[model samples]
Target: MGIELELHSERPTWTESEVWHTSRATLLRGSYEHGEALEQLLTRLGRDSPGGLGSVDRVGDTLFDEREAEAALREIPGLLRQCVHESQTVAVHDLATLLASCAATPGSHLWFMGD
Candidate 1:
């Protein structure tokens, strides 16, 4: 459905300095129809950031990045995947929410549709 990126400063809590980017690609395979959604997500992430922590911006094609976004993205997917694989009754909303959170932060990108 959609992916989001969430950033944090220390080990746990996200501060105002953190960024939140998001990308929502098409549900159909191979169609990257959600570019505007991704752009808007990035813009929102930037707006949420505390001044001097750097900027949140969209990158070429399907990439979005922020200074602190990258680190969070690196580990979140694996955790999600693990949850998906390990749990039989995993909540769809929870999974989607996790995906969105993962996609919104830095270094997170969505492969929507066919991608």
Candidate 2:
């Protein structure tokens, strides 16, 4: 029983609220803390989501749409680099790799299924 974030469709097709309204996309699957952090990071970037990343309503909810996902994909690289300076964990490493893959894949939906 852990966090599970997976991009539903290969192409992010929405960017409404980070977690609230996906319309018909895959929701990011993760823990409350992950959503908290995502809210912080995304909010800093001026994204929508007044309520912040919501609790797991469904396993297949998509956090960001195409545009929002693109933005996140761009921002994560810097954060991933920062992980290098901090004390890293296996989880961190795995997440970094996964994010990198998502970043690399043009239409790749990154799902969090690390349980």
How do the residues 1-115 of candidate 1 rate in per-residue lDDT, one tens digit apiece? Answer: 2332222212232234542221112111122233344333334333434431114334422232233333434433333343322231132223234344544544433222111
RMSD of 1: 14.4
Q: Please write out the lDDT profile of model 2 over residues 1-115, one tens digit for every residue.
A: 3444554446445565654456245443333334333333333333243322222223345443344444444444544443433322333444444455555556566543222
TM-score of each: 0.23, 0.35
Reference-based lDDT, residue 3, model 2: 49
Model 1 spans with C-alpha error above 4 angstroms? 1-31, 47-115
Best TM-score among the predictions, by candidate number: 2
- Alpha-carbon RMSD to native, per candidate: 14.4, 9.0
Q: What is the C-alpha lDDT of each candidate?
A: 0.32, 0.42
Best model number under lDDT: 2
Backbone clash count, each prediction separately: 16, 16
